[model samples]
Structure formats: C-alpha cells, structure tokens
Target: MTATQTKKALLNKIECAYMPVSDPGVSAEWYERVLGLKLRSPVKPGSGAIMIMGGGQWLFLLPSPGMTPLTFETTGWAGEGESFEMFPLCFETDDIAALHASLAESGTWTEAAVRDEGGCGLQLDFKDPDGNKYQAWQPPAQKGE
Candidate 1:
C-alpha cells in the first residue's frame, strides 16, 4: 500500500483520559459535586481518583507537580493560540444549554457562552478549582433527524 493509500485498521476508541491536577482529593470532590461525576474509586496512596462518564468511559485525575490547565480552546479544529490540547477531557452532553446554565450558575465556568461550531455542534469550556480545563460537547445530529 502506498503512503496515502495504506489499508490499516482503525484504532479502537479511547479507554480513559488522564487529567493532571494539583490535588487529587479536592479535584475529585469538585468533579463529583459540580459535574455530577460519581466517584468510582477514592484516591489511592500513589494513584488518583477514578470517575466514570455516562457511557462507561473512565476519567483518571492524577496528581502532578506544577500542572496547569491549557490556555487555548478548541472545537475539534485549529485556531490561533491553540495548543496541543494534551487531552482536555471533553464530556459529550445531550443538553448543552442546560449544562451551560448549571455551570454558569455555579460560578465556575470559564466562558460565558457556548461556541456554536456550524457542523460540530455546541461546546462549553470550564475549569475546576485547580484550574484544570475541561469541555462539554454536543455532537451534531445525524442525517434524517
């Protein structure tokens, strides 16, 4: 197969997202109370918190020294000031408006309005207590909807 026509199998879906935070315990509680993420496991001696998304996807919050949230934003596309995205831990949402309102009322959301990416649906970015950035994305509808 040529370089542009290689017939390789596609990789499987993502199993989990590793989030670096200043404190695992505090971040875990914020994710639980604010984002409604249930605690899958407590912080271990050397490990971190494990949270489960709706579709059984795992989110691991590990401790890291001098860890900081990404400064740029994304809608699955390139833009100025955008970084490598080092895994922003995007959560798929069914109701972006409701989620946005809730996060806004909590006074923790980073942005005021959701970005409506024409074909990609809506997205809202927010940060945790430790400044770990995250996103909630609502995928576009399929044809015949």
Candidate 2:
C-alpha cells in the first residue's frame, strides 16, 4: 500500500487470434490437416470456425470477402537495406527439422530451409492455404550435455 507500488498488469497472455480466410471450411480443413489444429465447431459457408492449437490457443478463421492474407514487410528487423516479410504469429516447436520435412512432403509453401538464428535458435517460415504467413521457432538446446 505504497504510492510507489503499482498494480499488476491486467493482460497476461493472448487467448485467441482471428484470421481472415477466403473459405472457412477449406481453411479449417487445412489447419487441421497441415498444422494439427482441431476444429472446435462445425464450419458453415459464410461463418467462422474455431481451431484449437496444441498449446490451447484458439484460432478463429473468419470468411473474408477481400481474402487478404495476414502478413507485412519490414526493413527494420532485417537491417537497413533489406526487407523482410514478417509473420504475425510464431509458434514454438521442439523439432523444427521434422516439421520442415512434413511441410515439404505436404507441398506446403515454405520460404526457405530451416536455419539457425543464433540466439533465436532454429526458424522456419511457411504460408497457409490462404497465403497467411507464419513462423515456427525451436529454442536453443539447454547447455548440460
């Protein structure tokens, strides 16, 4: 109960992410088959469906008339002259190599081969059926071997 003391921050974590898709049913199926997210509800033509990730986060795929994909380009992250297309969402994985192989076998659109990023560890970038860009990251192995 001091003046210098501040209350705890209200937000702790993100629970859900909303994405615009051309077709809810198709997107839902793609997520389930490709990324292993389970559909929480039945999909309708013009409606949205809730997809649950293994980490318990909900992804809502909503039908969009514009069909705009979720992605943006930035020069800041990649340095001054180079431009890098950033993925809004980055999912953590234990095995980046296996996931890369699976994505390739499925003919998914991946930016490039999985590479080590020093402090960031291994990273793989890929696009969904709707062209939404996303990244998968594998943390560096702990030192103790």
Candidate 3:
C-alpha cells in the first residue's frame, strides 16, 4: 500500500447510461419488449425515455437527429487485422441460452453463436433496431453450484 493512495474509490458505481435514438417512444418499446427493460417514464415522440434494467440500472434513450449508433470499431480484440465492433454497454444475464432464443424469435440481429470466453464466461453480441451494439454476458457458474 502506498502512503499517498486512499482505500476508498472516488466513484461509487455507474448509475445510468445514455444512448441516442431516432424516436424515443419507439426505442423505449423495443427495449421493453425485446430486452425486458421496464419503462420508467412516459415517452413522447420527441421526448426522452427512461428504462430500468433488471439490475436497477437506468438507461436513457434520447431522440437525436442523424445520431450514429453507440458503437466503435477496433482491430486487436478479435485478432490482428480482424475488425471488431465494440459496444459501450455490456449487460449481464443469468440465462444466456434463453435470452439468445428470445432474441432470435424477435428477429434481432446477433452474432451467429454465443462464445465461451473462458474465465470471462459466455458472451453474445447483438444490435438494437437502431443498430446500437450491445453485449450480454453470463458469468460462469460457481464451483459448488
């Protein structure tokens, strides 16, 4: 331990995340129907919407004109020379298989298969109707369970 370093972190936890959408009302419904997020606020055509995730995190969808999807591209994550689209938001799930099935039934775009990332557990990447990329992770089961 360093004398200058404090044990307490300056930040507590991430309370919310914001994403740009073409229509807040439509996007809010998609989030609620496909991802099971609860709409916490009334959404008008031009107004923003607040959604509550299973873990109590807040996701705000704001209407923006000509807004790009909240995603970025990098090369090294997938391997050298292979570009990979990275998502700013990574959600946690308990049942990856069921979620995958649900996404499929909804006709959502997703990676062909769920990947086992070893110590990082199972992972699946998908996109919203607006093309906002997101990742879902299912932690590896505990040894005793």
Candidate 4:
C-alpha cells in the first residue's frame, strides 16, 4: 500500500490495552468495583479477562509472572522527573469533580487529589491493589457549542 493509502487504511483506534497484573480476578474485581468497568468476559484463575470501558475501548487484564505489579508513572512536558501514573490505562469522564468525589468516598485507593490541567483537562490519580496507577480525565467544555 502507498503511504497515503496505508495511513488511511490504518485504524488508529486503540482496541484494548494490556495491563499486567498479579491476578486477573483481583484486578477485574477492582476495576469493576472502583472504576465501574463492566467485565466483557468471565476470567478463570490463570486466564485474563476483557473489560468494557465504554467508547470502544477495553482493558485486558492479563496475568504476569511477577508477583508484584509495576508502578505506573509519568512526567511533565519537561519529561525529566517521574510522577505516579497508570500510563497504559487512563480513563475518561464527563464530570471529573463528581467522579473524584465518588471515588474518594467509595473507599478505593486514590493516589492523589484532582489536578487542574489548564486547557487540557482535570486529572485525578488513583490505583488498584497492586500499585497500578490509573487516571480519570475530564476534558474542558467546548465554547459556543
């Protein structure tokens, strides 16, 4: 395929993101309870499961050899210092403050308070049982829509 055709043919949408977890059941339960994600399939002890996060996105909770889950982190535009983040699995919401408040009251593990991202969005960092950080983002409302 030519460059233009290839670019056009390429489906840029991300289907699912693979999240390495110590246990699929545990992670799946956490995602469902904390993030309100629906399980797309039933997962067994050694197997993984697909979760629907709405908007054509999915989370694949796969098993990993390491008992410990990796710490998800990110940095600012400078990209020098590291900050806690679930890089591979950032979630979106329409109302960030409500979500943050709900999660805070839900008794889940919230890593930090919500941050105002200027023109980007509102960000709230949280985590699962294995220290895998996740973020909730609410984009700025469009003007004169």
Best by lDDT: 3
Worst 10 residues of 3 by lDDT: 40-49
> Per-residue CA lDDT of candidate 4, range 40-66, in tens?
888977899788886868888889887
Ranking by TM-score: 3, 2, 1, 4
Residue 37 shift from truth in candidate 1, angstroms: 1.3
Q: Give lDDT tens digits, candidate 3, residues 69-132.
A: 9999988688968998889888899998888887887897988899998889999999988899
Per-residue lDDT tens digits of candidate 1, residues 1-145?
6778968678788889888888888888877777778889767766789988778888888988888764454455555555444335677998888877777777785678989987989888787777777778999877898
Cα error of candidate 4 at position 78, Å: 6.5
User: Judged by TM-score relative to the true structure, which candidate is superior, 1 or 2?
Assistant: 2
Order of models, best lDDT first: 3, 2, 1, 4
Residue pairs whose backbone atoms clash in candidate 3: none
* Candidate 4, run of 10 with poorest lDDT: 69-78
- The list of candidate 3 runs beyond 4 A from truth reads 1-8
List TM-scores for all candidates, in order: 0.76, 0.87, 0.90, 0.74
True-vs-predicted CA distance for residue 56, candidate 4, Å: 2.8
lDDT agreement with native, every candidate: 0.77, 0.88, 0.90, 0.75
In TM-score terms, candidate 1 sits at 0.76
